[model samples]
Target: MSRWLPWAVGLVAAVLALGPALGPGYVLRYDMVFVPDLSLPTVLRGADGFPRAIPSDAVVAALSWVLPGDAVQSAALAAVFVVGAAGAARLMPSPAAAVVAGAAYVWNPFVAERLLLGQWAMLLGYAGLPWVVGAARGPLAGVVRSLIPAAVGGFSSVVLTALTAGPVALWGRGGLRRGGLLAGALVVVSLPWLVPALTAGAAGATTDPAGVEAFAPRADTPLGTAGSLFLLGGVWNAHAVPAGYGDPVAVALRLALCLAAVAGWAWWLYRDRPGFGPGLTAAAVLGFGVALLGATEPGRGVLAWLIGLWPGFGPLRDGQLYVAPLALVQALGLGAAALWLSRPAGGTADGPGDGGAGAAGRGAGEPGSSAEPGPAGPGGRRAHGVGRIAGVAAAAGLAVLPVVALPGLLWGAQGALAPAEYPRDWLAAQAAVAADDRPGAVLVLPWSAYRGIDWSGGPAVVLDPATRLFDRRTVWNDDLVVGTPDGGTVVVRGEDGLAREAAAVLGPDPRTGLPESLDAAGLAALGVRYVAVSAPVDNRFWSDVDGFSVVVEGPEMTLLEVLAGPINTEEADISGLEVTCGLVTVGAIIWSVARSGSSLGFQRTGVERRPGARKEIP
Candidate 1:
């Protein structure tokens, strides 16, 4: 019964955070980034064959077949909180501490901000870190248990999990065996994203200065930075910051709460003396330092240098991501503190103490001078009373920070999965595109790669909706360029820009139409059979365009047919390689899951370290 309580609390918090946005239509953020490319075949092929870590996308796509896409997203969102709490609890010394830690992790400002940003893929890694830590603590069986979740988490998340688990796996004698097993499992699980990334030479393109700056932590001071991260509010986008972001009162209260939690955890670490406490502390500091380093010019410069040297390092540009591990470590520390305060007057004989006869009793050491055993035996009400008071204080400290910092989180920022209806004409336009039996591509007018959407009310700039507006194959303009050694940026279009060169011939002015820019012959040469415009445009853009006829003229948009375009059906030799790699990735995960008997349980409860476990600090 105690085991279920923390999960119950976490579930309720997660539901409250996402309750309003659970709808039938795709949410603004989900549709903007994920919906456009939600097809299974597309995932198998890899997103533009550039290794953008589409495994999570592929899994979500596969799940959509069995469940409604909206339901799958809701479940995934809820799992972030549920798994986070469960894993955190496994590392904690007591149930009370676990409950508090779980709530603190799930309801904090960082989780709230990322949720609002609609970065589900990155969050998946955040959710999986605790389990990774548990599995890496030394046991071949544990590594086997960690594969399924790691695979489902996608590539970026797997990397985050590795950061947390690697330190633990590398400590003590014979650590190499356990660590090697863990690393091999991670590699196998990450193949879906890793394989494509290696094959497609565009991995370096992902780490742009713009992306680095976009998610960097923005705080006034070091203390402020730590406080904001503790409350989960380090996102660089000003508009996306938590409610009451820069208010003096809110800021002060948040810092106070963070200080209290950290101080409380430190006190608990001193008293409780859990074996992993020191390592967790180090991991927290390292993660915090890395995140802070990425927020400044020097950090970005360093990252830029790394990206130039190795394309795989490109994903690390978003320094804010480092905050997840720090946040996890903090949550666990807070839990340990709460549990310490609630212990009996003499402390539990089986509780985790700093090498004392408590939770770490297997190799317990002397108690601190102030922590000497009391005359009162276990279950004494007097000590319990004092402990209850301390427990309340710790929980209060952990909860207040997020509550005050992100008050509007529960009521705002949710995007509907499925609404009752879309603009009727928009639906008709999509139907027309899907109806076309031909294999030609589409050209979306106001042809750029990104724009503010109607659903999100222009709060953030997202990928162009035109890409997802049609069921037929489509093409859009390139938004990023890769840097070459010669100081020139090269535009590499993997798969999407089928008609880019031809579309380039059409001058930027859409209103000028075919006469001055492109004629019917040019349209045919580009292999573009259709064009759709969602935003308002002058009638002249379509009126004078030759070899095109109005197919569906709706109040919100216009759909045109390119009556004389030639469709190209050439296949790439590399297509077979992509499919084969995807298959092997899918098969490996399935085989591992079967071999492990589907037991992905994180059983790291209690304080018994594996025999021969090294005492060396990570």
Candidate 2:
């Protein structure tokens, strides 16, 4: 009945350690806020303001449904991970081994944030992993075998989670094979949500423009590469590695101790008969090294790298900075060492009397049984070594967890500093165009406001009662825009240095030696609507142009709707298809999942997904 003592102790310790995040710090320190933008009720988009991005929206939506309170839902996620880490910790042979691995895990910035924020699906994945590793150990008596699956099936996001537990279902042997098959069936059950994400161009297809561009890789490759591997953790957000982890002083010391611990344990394992599977040990070491180096890419990653070549390895782009294979390696290395140490030197049976996982206590079998322990000769040495590693890790954690995780508790995770606000006055000026125009009208706004365009929400924002314009795309001198007969819009950008270029745009084409200026008659000829000028450029733009009535002029921006009326005569020669380049990635994901990969398939996309538009109340 009590064969699972180590696991239970580990679980309790994990819980007690991390419970602090669920309180005041989580809200102030995370993106998960109680402020409701109400974007979850419908689809969310950027400029089109019509069809919504369902994948990211759906997860938030689900949370809205399950737990009515946002804070509760958020804390619940942290709790889930606490349980997951605990369960995984519990699976280790000794509480000390669990402590070392758990310390490495909790100290990781990404891991802590994921647990603290409502990364519900990821926490589930984390929960399932312990079971997967434990079940791989064959059989354990006293504990209910049925509990094995709870660990494996833990992290299935409706879309990507399938990839996580999918591999085992294919060709695994014994319990893992059976459970993998069962998990595969369960993933199949979730196909309704997963299949459409593949076809629709959301899941693997996404390549967020806003994320990766902020960190220019082409500009600095090596630092970027190392940083991508070190910090950021995922491909999309993979940028500069932080000063932690490999902290010149901290990591150097940690590595020295880890090396020393490994040396002691290796000697212990090689002493007597020289048993233990070489393949298992090799896999652990290799996995640990790669994981320690961390994930270089975010999403699915570059097509053919050695680690990525492995099936399911594609999605496992993040969290490798310090967790992933490191956990498994530590597990195997420590487990083997523990087992080896518990062996009595002279070969005398210690039975359940020795202070090891002693012969199946309680309902567990007696001396010669399957789950029983051997003699306790030098078992104390390995236990002591494992304990030393934990002490080192704990010491390192004490150093970092305070300096890093403490103040992070004060603010949300997005920008460490407050970003300058967008010029809402220009947006408000643009907003006025809707009031003057007819219902469901298309209003062409300046390209600058495109970032927050979709916040208008629902049926209203798509075709507002304003002139329809491609604010994010079409701009002054844009070929199709200037060539079109739609004039009920505005063009806003920095007019200071751009005057000459602006003059050239509204004037003629020097390249072809042709004149393209639309006169007052040309304004009607080119669907002249509005040209909202931001700030005071030169008076020349107003003087040169024939008819520009100032409908409303604010402190910083000016509204310039053309008096020439609507010119629907000609359509702009716009080219290119409206493709969500990020969504196009589904093809590659489909190909990879169907085909074979090189190593163990990667497991997670640790970066946060885009947030839904938060529409301001009228």
Candidate 3:
């Protein structure tokens, strides 16, 4: 069971990593997508528009687009697992000790979260940095290959912002000068996009306040401020993302496992070479950071100082990303501790050169110490020490107990998957819209209904009644943009004249209703011809409208031909509303999902409830 345990955990982990791409969460946004480039519909759909930040999941998306999700996630995960194991083995002081470290990491919740929740940026950083660290201390050939890591770190920066830059800049034992020079070069190169982004940012485009945004939040409040830092330190059981995100059970278990790992790591370091000093220094600094950040003024003084000093950190608002390095360091330390703990307490019974035993206790001063430093590198006849059993047990505890709590996770994933409880409506209304997208027609379909228009090159705007009238804020933008007035063939949807009413709010068509024919109007100028409405009555927005033409009717959705009136200033205003909505809706979904949930599981659970409702409500 112990031997198979690692493989079993790995297989399940791989599957969980594959879940996002294989399931509805990824595909659901295929329609209202935002790409990194401002040019809409040019490439992939993203939560943010044309931003340098790429979703870390894009790696998985690219892979899933080609092969199956399982293979892609597994391969990526395998690389992390293997590299992590190798690193531990090299440092564990013994081969068996290294094995124990491997078991601990593979089964840890930190690794589990990264794999399962699409934390590709962190994973990528882990993959690249270790290689860079090895290269920094290894041969010239390794340094030359370090370019691979440097380059990957550049892309990962786009995912996690400037956070990934830390490992690349400082992973090696090289002096600060060398690290500074390398980091400076990377920063200079990264500036093209960063510059434009800052320039764009300077324009002060307001970030769409989606979810429970604590905009202009009170950094002065002691309790809230303390809560933020507590959350950041991973000291008080931090959730994964957004606000209060993370499994409570996983949170508790994660904390316990993390503690175990850190303790074991300390033991390993001490066993390999006794030194309470460095570990004590690290603890002091961390505790200080926690204290300073938790003070009444979170944005000033020591909290600010910590952020500035936290190497490679850039301007970031959220405190969650700050905790990553500490987590990894703790894990590595734990692995080392496990190595030490695994060795026989009596002494180097294995032999003087044995690493496992060397790691377990300071023992008789071996040549590897300052006295010997061993026979140079891995080629040295170092003793292979026994692995730590407690570390293994702790890791095992995490993997198994989670299984015990699987029932809770089911509710979590299922709830997240079921956010919006809308009745299923398939292609019923889609049939009426032209199958092939025609270039010249000013086509208009009901909001959220894209039957025929080729979204391949253009974008879809929802012309729903609820959207046009009530509050006018959309996930896209807080306000709408009105369009130029030109009489276009109006295609009204459904039996209700509400589409007409929604149409009338803009201009000439407000009371008169959509005209019967439109020919001379330019596609963009005339707005949309043939509106589609779903409701049959003169609903809230449509009660004042004249009539509508139903092209198709079905049990599920209805399609109608709506003749919209001449484009006027009123229409232009509405178009701005679209832009506003697109800004809020398209740009902020990821921010919302990652940051807004009451609990970490809620992010996933809330997603299933009704994605639209979540945005709409707040």
Candidate 4:
């Protein structure tokens, strides 16, 4: 209970501090466009409902049953920060060190940019890193423990965790066997998303190599990319940078802090301590290397080769995403730095209750009765001098904390800003969509999937709310859009033809009527029955639209009923595969739980004897 007190307090405090930004309204930024639609079966299935490969969608869908969809999304965001902090603490030597590292991890420029860009899906992977680290270090460590976060966060965390497990197994006794078990566990958990992702190409959801490189970290060379990796500043969207980010002073300050943090952590790593293991250092370097691969031509070639081998490997398109593991590394480094700053005049940080080697051993949960002994006394003057330099650098890092955290970062987490409230017109439009008794799809005009909805109070590109707003089946564009409202027409960055068709259907001349250019028969073939037009976009094309009548016209939306023909195409058949994967995951989980002396049906507990220990109740 005492072990949990710090975490509970920190989580509650974080929620209160962040509530204003994340409470009530729906954030309309980037992929947050889809969060509100978490309850929709079609969205959970993803992209024309052919692929149930989106693990985040599955989590949202499951939670939506118990909580409001928006609340679930909000809670999930808070959980990422909270869990990430907990994980940082779990991997650190003392509570204070953990708090510093947790703060660094959750409240950094990288986290801010991702949250602002609405990369909550990827953030889940980031949040799960600490858990992966913790599980790897525990006495009962196994493949299942190492890969459980993968079940929650998908392949991103799986790759990162696997990297961490590599050094863990390789650098320790029985390493190979343990590593193999971890790999097998990863495969089992991955079947949920991996099986569907492998088959997604057949469902027209393939990501071309060009698309894969679209969000590649932009750097002059692999070395430059590696440099940026440690700094935590390689977002694909330049606009995603924090306010005043490029200022010379800000850059220099951030760079200095980054170096200090890394140096401090490096110092701690060399110590024969029980803090974060060698695996984290190895994982950080590997993650940085992978992130750099996208920026260099040779690296891109390697990436191309990998993509060629695995079709489901498309999500790694955002090369910057690989920087996730590094963020944790930086946090750890900063935590180690903080410990150095708190050290007394002595070079050795073995003071009573100081959380140096002793705290490290306890935190690591190593099979030891007490902290390892330190040198009998302070060694020399040169040692103290070197310690002082490291302490000063750590202090500098502490200074830069606010600059990287605060609301100055691209308007401080766009998704966390006051939520966009559902307008009355949106409610009416949703009701209208719900009234359609026939099986049909609702298409929102100005057909691009990403739009700069003015209500969210920022220029961040967000997914069209219509996808979630309409309770009926939705026929919308499928592409990763990155742009601003003032930037004019939103650009379709992905190579999906359906997205291009959506742009073409909207036509070059938006002032002209939509039906004038659209073939009603063609649309009928796709099962589109109604079109909802939101404000600020030209709807003159609808004035001359034939065979359709305005069903509901509100301040925010104009719904038009399609009168032409019945849609002919068969609904996609994905239920069988979705069900199969769900059943397999559930079965595995149930079996694992049962083997652990637990039951989902009722409260049942059992304990067995361990070697050199007495038998427990069963």
Which numbered prediction scores highest in TM-score against the true structure? 1
What is the clash tally of candidate 3?
A: 100
**Candidate order by decreasing TM-score:** 1, 4, 3, 2
User: Candidates' lDDT values, in order?
Assistant: 0.60, 0.34, 0.34, 0.59
Please give, for residues 424-517, the per-residue lDDT of candidate 1 as tens digits.
6766777877776766666776655555556543345555555655654455655433343345444433334443465566655433222243
Which ranges of candidate 3 are over 4 A from the true structure?
1-12, 16-41, 44-52, 55-174, 180-256, 270-315, 348-475, 478-618
TM-score between model 4 and native: 0.79
Task: Estimate, for each residue in 1-618, the C-alpha lDDT of model 4 and write its tens digit.
Answer: 424533653475356435555567676677665444454465444553224336667777777777877787677777776766666655565445555777777766677667767767667667766665654433332335434446766766666567655565455556676566666666777776766656654355545565445567753213255565567877777656656555556656667767877887787665533323566677777777777777777877777677667655765567777676677778877877776675534434322133432323332113432223323446644565566566656555573474454445422343345566777777787776776667777777655566666666555577777766765556666655444325633333443444355556555343422334455555665667787776543456566556677888876778877777876544444567766876776566566555545322111111111123321111
RMSD of each: 5.9, 15.3, 15.8, 7.3
| Clashes within 3 Å, all models in order | 18, 49, 100, 6
Q: What lDDT score goes with residue 492 in model 2?
A: 20
The per-residue C-alpha lDDT of model 1 at residue 210 equals: 48
By summed lDDT, which 10 consecutive residues of candidate 2 come out lowest? 457-466
State TM-scores per candidate: 0.81, 0.44, 0.49, 0.79
lDDT of 4: 0.59
Which clashing pairs does model 4 show?
21-416, 25-419, 30-462, 512-541, 513-541, 514-541
Off by over 4 Å in 4: 5-19, 34-37, 48-53, 137-149, 164-171, 199-204, 219-226, 273-276, 301-316, 343-347, 350-416, 481-516, 536-540, 587-618
**Candidate 1 or 2, higher TM-score?**
1
Candidate 2 C-alpha lDDT tens digits along 456-558: 2211111111222112111233211111113232222221222223334456443422233234444444444556544433445455666656665655455
